[model samples]
Target chain A: MALRFALMIDPLAADQTAPDLATTFTAVDPAAPALTVGELSTQRGDGIFESIGVVGGHPQEVEAHLERLVHSARLCDLPEPNVAQWRAAVAIAASECGEGEGVVKLILSRGVEHGPTPTAWATAATAADFSLARTEGIRVVTLDRGYAIDAPARAPWLLLGAKTLSYAVNMAALREAHRRDADDAVFLSSDGFVLEAPTASLILQRGDTFITPAPNGAILHGTTQLSLFEHLAARGFETAYETIPVDELRRADAAWLVSSVRLAAPIRQLDGADLTVDAEFTASLNDYLLSPRD
Target chain B: MALRFALMIDPLAADQTAPDLATTFTAVDPAAPALTVGELSTQRGDGIFESIGVVGGHPQEVEAHLERLVHSARLCDLPEPNVAQWRAAVAIAASECGEGEGVVKLILSRGVEHGPTPTAWATAATAADFSLARTEGIRVVTLDRGYAIDAPARAPWLLLGAKTLSYAVNMAALREAHRRDADDAVFLSSDGFVLEAPTASLILQRGDTFITPAPNGAILHGTTQLSLFEHLAARGFETAYETIPVDELRRADAAWLVSSVRLAAPIRQLDGADLTVDAEFTASLNDYLLSPRD
Candidate 1:
């Protein structure tokens, strides 16, 4: 599929009348490059971003994504992004990719190294297939995130809770999992606390209760997980947030990795060891996650 | 000064006659943009980079920077960069800057998300002045890097030694330091061992011995520090690599932050506490650091 892109050099100044900023162009090519080599986003990964799932041309959990984007920008000390501009951009991109499931990304960066303006853009592209993993479950490996559970509290400079573009280490952890013949990875703190996954949140079943790690500044609060917990609470399921030990993962009745695009993928095996999985529960949880909502 | 940039889509295939790839472009304007929104470098920070100082249009310590670039790529599992192509590009950029001190950066990224090739570029711009810091010295604050000293050794997936473009945390640390009324920062491990500065190497004077933190996989092996150690050793100054405790920094006679561009800037104070600095000694060290070398 040909990827569609739109660039707003100064997204803050974007108004309804600006065609390139308001309307998604199919083939309306324009002059001037979208980015320069000196952009902080290119040179230093100094930016905040969000990837929203588009199902049948409708964005899923956009308000949560936007809230997280603002929180991330605050962590990086970047200027506040114009949420109306972002909403408009997302609408254009989603409309352009009509009737199909796609990925819409909102990127707000600290512009050029020497320039004061921030660079923002929206992109629409075909989503990758996670159908097999979502149905058949996935195998995972445990990797160390090289931090103690309290690391973030002591060191805010780490930007642990922010969804920034400096994801090289996260990508490396995923590649290491792939090399070890696993489909995904769950990170463990150096002090033996179970952290979140590289790009997802961890959820496990303990008896009839659904438990996930607390948002202790070491992990990005999972938007999908929040939605799932609300749905589960409405259906008479007990939900809790606490620090989980790595060993407890093996003892859980069932485990899953939850995210924006993939929803909830059950864990069939971890570190080459088989784990319990309830397929019926997995399907029901995915149903609740993917169901239409504002 | 207007920054000069040259893009090489596939630098590995660069040859003498490929003007756009081998020879730096002056004004060969293109209709299409150089970077797309889907670039991994912009989106995920999946790239490696090097900044070399050019004096009188000659790139300083090119060999050391290139060696580090290769080492960084290996850590990231990125495709090997073509050194010959990089050399040609750097030469052209430095030449274009013409007879003045400048900064030339070599950036190699994982290309666009949909493309298989890597994107490489060389940018030349006037260097920022460090004359004040070099002469009057700088005050520094110590911040925790939120990692144990042994974290990197046990977790290679952290990409600790690789100088990747995912530098958001580094940039944040600098900003934090600036907010605290300091000019720079020195990061300490969670276990209380001094690691390195946000963008430079930490060198402390313990009597006559020059002590620096060993490359324990948690810090980038600094090129400027290595050159300074060699220069000091030749001049009958003792040097050693060992893990320096944070307390030692407070009691040290002198300290300096060393980097390729900034060279050597003496530390006037640490965490608002004054320290001894011999101006004559600092000037001599700067002279040795900037002296002609291959």
Candidate 2:
């Protein structure tokens, strides 16, 4: 299949192509068809993706997201995406968001069968409101991720480190959480150690210090959590990365699931057991998360 | 996004819409843009699919594939497909393949974000040549599937048995096998039990009895393996399904990775060690596989 996105950028009226490639991405209609029937993105889910939270038309943590995108590309053996082209695409996507909290998804597929180029695109959509989730916090259920903590190291092919488009398991875990009457889920490794949420990273407050599971190949290294840790460090609260046991979670004074779009949402209850939700502390964290980052 | 496939089947002209949905599916151009960028299939890999082997214009194991399709939908919570429509689509897909072996892939995606209906279609393509693999047999390596055999039953949301399109790990395992200088890979459960292949089923011939892993919700129920077992039983060979351990494979007199498209390819070697490859027996199995079946 020919690159439909490439055709959208090539020889045609500047109006048809939308002015200039330097200033604009291929103008796309959300209601129009964009990918071929054989694109691997849809066919095999052989692709990598990132969802950047855009606030007030300003994309957050672009560098970190782009770095992780490159890392995911390496892990998946997908061709490294051209950072300049993607940055431009992300700009185009951010412009489409207009204002307020939005999410811009950057996707890089292995492309159609035997096609010359990878299918790359950015889509911007309005973010779902997580005001209640951020304030009142969220109820979470812990589910087994079905892999040992060291599995990713032993079996790199499992792709535990990559942020791939093959997120059916992640989506299913959320559904399972809802079935258990909780709003979200935190995944545990098969050998009974804490991991992260399907779409987010986990950070727990133990007395005074904050701790998250170490980035040991079994989990996607959390960009938001890193930035939050930096912010916490600046505020004189100790932060660390550790191998968290399942029991350590219960001992946590407070917990939060941190992500790009929803920011920091405190865990009000985990498995029907109440956790200390410091409303004031969580608001401070959210406020910091909402702040402009370069 | 609008249903582009539906648009292909809708009115402007009968030539445009094709003959009839009852007899013919919407005539599709394989290279054309058929899916929107927002589709959950591409976005989250949230979909179910089946690839049926078609030989001499006859689709093999139609009822079994359709039954599995329904089983997958139930596990994934997707809308139960209209069987009659899918059967007609399959016939149309099968017709697209002329005189040789071909593959018709049926995909039912969760559709575009907020779309009213699921996006469904079938695409017909020429099968890859597996002559060398089928005749000389293939070298196989074992990789950990990262889940215990009982994990599927314990966690229904893991979608262990469902034939979903989130096959990144499956694709990755094959890459790992190739890197290790092997042609294919067999998945072993983390708790030391034989699972299936990334895209095929495993059958071991221990002495006179042919055995496959039991369908205990851990591995997929292979349609091709089941057909082959039935054929073997008819030939007066004993056939059984049992919980095969990883050790039992090495002790087996012979083994084969069976699937649609590729059919039956015997295991010539396991992790560089030679296994007994019975050329005449494998050829007979392929002959049965290639025979016209409703």
Candidate 3:
């Protein structure tokens, strides 16, 4: 079976030179595209973004994605992009999507023209490949130091949950994890609460309850995880938004990383600790994901 | 004399669509002068920017600006750009700069790319009119909501003192101040500390005691401020990096906004409250500004 992807990744064995991804993608058309870039970044560092998997010539759950995009933007105190324009742009980009499944990303920034104004926003889509997920569930690491979101004032400015452009720290944390010979990283709040894995959703099962961090101002409200909740609910699993303690998760029935690309990847081993319930939950979740979303 | 500017307002009325300031300036390159829209933006907003003003039309202080750029990039945790390439790009841009007391601005940004990764940054330069500073001192409003730099882990993430692309908040604050019928805005930290004015350097008072927020972590270290400090030392004024409360500033013997563009603008008011600082400091600072360094 051939894989479908939004991004085309040339295999390490392929001969052709990788395209200058940066320069080639910019539009020559000035007026609208100009507005798009600025508006997309309107929230300064208080916006949300999604990099999703487009499979079998269809961007799965696009409606759900757009819905979350709008919700995330509003929560971040940003003016919404015209939904029609957004849908059209995504559809136009999706139509030209090449062979195989790839990745499509959406960003909603503070739309502040001068970087501090906070007025406009822009959203653009790009297709890329991530077949790497199919072969290996990422080797994840944990940060010894954690983020502090202890105050209400801190809550408003703690842009981590909003997925804003102020992503340097988060990316830095991931890089630190990578440097430690880990594929990805999970952040713990300074008080030792398990926060999140960089750029993906979290779901841990303890008996019948599927638990993750509450999508309050402290955590990014992930669309993929919300969708998975529906399946968990129908299957008689109690879904929850309460904070799951690190100790509890390590002892949970099963744990999985849910994201658009690797729909449900089992947490094979976390920080060298083997998770016992990986296989059963991994198979069940994959079966549900392979079924049509109608 | 008729002023040459990219967007100068008519003093007589709101004639925003006046004839071109220069008949020779064109949208194209070479004999006809050209400027990118992004270049025009550096002058707008209380936009935090570094300019080692032009000398004989050649951009001086490239190293200083580059050093500050890297520092700003680090403060904002932005991906490092190729400094050598940037230097070469600015040199090429500087060569295109025509003479007559103008400044060359090196504006670094996330460029037009969207998503998790940023596209390459670009720099452009254009001639600026310095005559505006030779005449008028600016009017400014002081805002009391000061900057956030108290958090131990997060305070280091404050981009206050660096000239970064995320300047929309400053621009918006200026607009808010303008809407309140003020020319510009001065930022006051939450603790009543008198930080730097929106675009310019801090206002220090008396001969031996000048006050501005310590560049410890909260403010962009101003190149012009550094120059002023050097001259202040030579003139027997002891420049100290101590935090001055807003109440002390309101009662200061004198105050002025120092910057590359305004050079030295005497602060006539703090918010709507009046200031009694004499205009002589503006002249002395101006002298220090135009005087060639050894």
Candidate 1 residues B126-172, lDDT tens each? 77878889989999999999999999989999999999999999999
Every candidate's TM-score, chain A alone = 0.92, 0.92, 0.73
Off by over 4 Å in 1: A7-9, A14-33, B7-9, B12-33
Residue A285 of candidate 2: its Cα lDDT? 93
Candidate 1 residue lDDT tens string, A101-123: 67788888888766656877777
Pairs of residues clashing in candidate 2: none
lDDT of 2 by residue, A1-294 (tens): 111122122112123234345443576766688788887889788899998988888999998999999999999888766666666677767777766788888888877777635777778888888999999999999999999999998899999999999998998999999989999999999898999999999999997899999999999989899999999999999999999999999889999999999999999999999998999999999988888875
- Model 2 DockQ vs. reference: 0.49
Tens-digit lDDT track of model 3 for B128-210? 55445444555677764323434223433333456654444454556667777876777766556767765677766854677
The DockQ of each candidate is 0.57, 0.49, 0.08
> Model 3 misses residue A182 by how many Å?
2.7
Model 2: residues with Cα > 4 Å off, grouped in runs:
A1-24, B1-25
Top model number, TM-score: 1
The best-first sequence of candidates by lDDT reads 2, 1, 3
Worst 10 residues of 1 chain A by lDDT: A23-32
True lDDT of residue B138, candidate 3? 54
Q: Which ten residues in a row are the worst by lDDT in model 2 chain A? A: A1-10
